[model samples]
Target: MILHTFTLTLGSTRPIYGSAHELRGFFATKFTEYTELHQHNADKFIYRYPVVQYKMIENVPTVIGINEGAEVLKQIFNDYQEIRLGENTYQIVERGISLKDEEFGISDKIHSYVFMTPWLALNQENYRKFYTLKGKPERDEFMRKILTGNILSMAKSLNYDVPGQIKCDTNVRFQKDRLKDVSVMVFSGKFHTNFLIPDLLGIGKSVSRGFGAVQQLKANNEGGSTCSSSSTQGAPT
Candidate 1:
């Protein structure tokens, strides 16, 4: 899953609404919002660069990605485990970075926001189309620059170095590719023993499923999940 953290700048106490699908819908909505404000100029460069936007005019006072999910993810901080990526150690929480909950960081002028997720279905479809096309050397180069640049920029902006890059699958591949995905218990509450995920053996789904699902599950039982794979307890060699 993508690991990201956001501060509740709008207020000290915030609550999250909707599902992963709804959250994705909201991100998609940001695209439209950007367009309506005549901010689509940024999109032209966004998909091809390390920057979030080319035009600074539209950088409104809102958040994107994981920031929207800030309400439902408080206990998220306790889920972290250490991982070896390239040469550095990263705190991996919720299958990604182990950032402090609701903590905000700076990025020059704008407040840098962080968030993460498994590959959404749409993102995967687009990637397959772009990355799998053979003999298109130029397109591949562009993809590498944009995707890698974004990740690198993100790390550098946080004053951290880029470790080995992480690319999560569309929940499906995470399950089928259990040998690659790390296994961690998703503890349900403040208590370490209660887990949202049932078994330690988990795998991301390897198929495409429409929409996404997060939970309203209580500490006693976890709601239905989207899916991932189980792996040995440590970093991959």
Candidate 2:
């Protein structure tokens, strides 16, 4: 399947300091007509894969649009000249936009990826189950399943039918994090999977707020496996 992706990066005169959630709020409020920007319909949350994701890469405000979201991004690429975040308004000095068609599906080779941001892999229920596991082996296996499910969810959202089962292995460490003032557990690590995912795409929960952004590292030879390295802690941008 060909996944259509659009990325927009904004540069300001000075450093921009804000969370992806704040950045999203700026756009969702400005483009209230575009429900995809915020994934909301009349105060009710739309529970599906988010086509549009907000992020802060290297302290720069970035927005990613997938498939239908890509078209919406194109229509509003030039609609704004400035952005406001928490009482600070920054003038947009540079705008970078990219549109590409990327291959998306199961591959024969195992591809490695690192989480550029924290992966919100567990919810309250899953957190209890995860802790109940006996040892590292059990926990690792559990996380692998979660990772595979994340990939399948993304494929389903894109309407792509997977012909084969996805295989995933993860090397992650748990960390304490907070989401929306609630304490939560997050992971920072790398995983190897047969599924091919676009760079900067997110997985797991609260992805619209920039959690779980992944960057591809390398792809091993077909039918070969690559081990994942220990991941360091990373805070959300």
Candidate 3:
């Protein structure tokens, strides 16, 4: 999996919410061509994988660009400096870029995994219906099925073909603060993990704006069999 993360450290400290929207707006101003591609894809109702995704981490607007997007971002932002977010203008004080692959401790084999971001698994119709329906138990069960299916669909779209029935367990919590009800899910089970490709690739709806971004929280150890993951106790980002 070839993935590159570009962390644009900002000079401002003011609280900036709805960063995904701001990031998209910035791309529209500077990278109009790519921005148009994003809009076009969204309108087409296609599964065309988004190469670039943006999120705010530690007051820094980080762009996790994969494959072609990585090259584009490096070319544009490498020489260009500074980007604005919302009402507050931020100076690009520092820029950090790094790549992650097999050497980065990501296992090729399948194993239990957790999400670094919430996993959104519904479309426009299903999403609205899900919220309108009553009963937490039924909602939770439906969420698990949809999420697992979405993962499989994502893998297929990425050319990671897995045969037969794939089993997975999901533990998720609904985050109401987002644009809608997004589920923060931890997925565990056995399957090929190599096809997941890009680190922090968004899975479901609004992926271009960073809705379903995920990171592997576990990796197979040197033993090639045992998986290792640290216990992170904190609120979901």
| Ranking of candidates on TM-score, top first | 2, 3, 1
- lDDT (10s digit) by residue, model 2, range 113-201: 89998999876777888999999888887787677667777777778887876766888999988888889999998888888889999
lDDT of 3 by residue, 1-237 (tens): 333444333343444444775876687567666643244443463345566677665445667665566666766765455567776666555666766542222344554444545555565656676778689766655654565555555544445445434333445566543553544333222222332334556666566666666655466322121111221111121
Model 3 CA deviation exceeding 4 Å by range? 1-18, 35-47, 102-113, 128-137, 178-198, 219-237
Report residue 148 deviation for candidate 1 (angstroms).
Answer: 12
> Model 1: per-residue lDDT, tens digit, 18-122?
222232233333345433112236446221111111100111112222322332233332333432223433332322222233322211221111112222122
The estimated TM-scores of all candidates read 0.22, 0.91, 0.67
Error of 1 at 101 (Å): 8.7
Best by TM-score: 2
Rank candidates by lDDT, best first: 2, 3, 1
Cα error, candidate 1, residue 40 (Å): 5.8
Cα lDDT listed for each candidate: 0.24, 0.83, 0.52
Best by lDDT: 2
Clashes of each: 17, 0, 0
Q: What is the lDDT of candidate 3?
A: 0.52
Model 3 C-alpha RMSD vs. true structure (Å) is 7.9
